[model samples]
Target: MAFWTYMLRCVDGHYYVGHTDDLDARIAGHQSGLIGGYTQKRRPVKLVWWQEFPSRAEALAAERQIKGWSRAKKQALIAGDWESISRLARSRSCR
Candidate 1:
């Protein structure tokens, strides 16, 4: 089965990161507010980015890593700006 690490742009303009085995169903749940928690309160989220992984562990790891990233880094990722992601990582570590 394919697992996915996904990012959602919430109604409040915040990002939500998560991993799921069923990306479509999970996203549907969030859209309908059927999945309670952070996303439930910030309904009407749009899937800004996602990546499929061969294993759930890898997807989960990606989700966790993304959740810790700064907003600028996440935006860089959404824009597929690997150079900026790298630069941001290096800059962050130097601080």
Candidate 2:
């Protein structure tokens, strides 16, 4: 069972983070507004980042950790700026 922690860029520019075992179907639900939740009000969502974990626990932990990141750090991650991401992570760890 492959679980994924995904980040979505919402219509209003906010980010949503969640974990699911079904990536494609989950994203579809978000896009179609079929899932009545926070994302539903946000309407269209774009998958800006994702990571695969071998276990559900790992995926969920990563999701929770990412959710705590500042918007700038999150955007850096989404932009694939590994240098900035590493710096942010290290800075956070020291705090």
Candidate 3:
């Protein structure tokens, strides 16, 4: 089965990241508040970005990676600006 890592733009103007094997059902649950948690509390989320992975491990890794990104980087990612995203990523100080 294909695993997907998705990013949601919540009504509160915040972002949510998650991984699932069923993208459609998962997004539906978030929209309907059937999954009561961060996204549910924020409610009425819209999909901003998503990536498909061949393995669950890859999906989970990507989810974690995206979650740690700065808001500017995340926005760049959602905007599909690979150049800016990579530039922001490299600009971060490891210290």
Evaluated with lDDT, which candidate comes out highest?
A: 1
Candidate 1 residues 16-93, lDDT tens each? 999999999999999999999999999899999999999999999999999999999999999999999999999999
Tens-place lDDT digits, model 2, residues 1-95: 89999999999999999999999999999999998898999978999999999999999999999999999899998999999998988998899
Best-first order by TM-score: 1, 3, 2
lDDT of 3 by residue, 1-95 (tens): 89999999999999999999999999999999999989878988999999999999999999999999999999999999999987897889644
- Each candidate's clash count: 0, 0, 0
Please, what is the TM-score per model?
0.98, 0.91, 0.95
Estimate candidate 1's alpha-carbon lDDT, on a 0 to 1 scale: 0.98
User: Which ranges of candidate 3 are over 4 A from the true structure?
Assistant: none
Which parts of model 1 are misplaced by more than 4 Å?
Answer: none
Better of 2 and 3 by lDDT: 2
Model 3's number of clashes is 0
User: How displaced is residue 91 in candidate 1, in Å?
Assistant: 0.3
Instruction: Extract clashing residue pairs from model 2.
Output: none
Question: What are the Cα lDDT values of the candidates?
Answer: 0.98, 0.95, 0.94
Rank the candidate models, highest lDDT first.
1, 2, 3
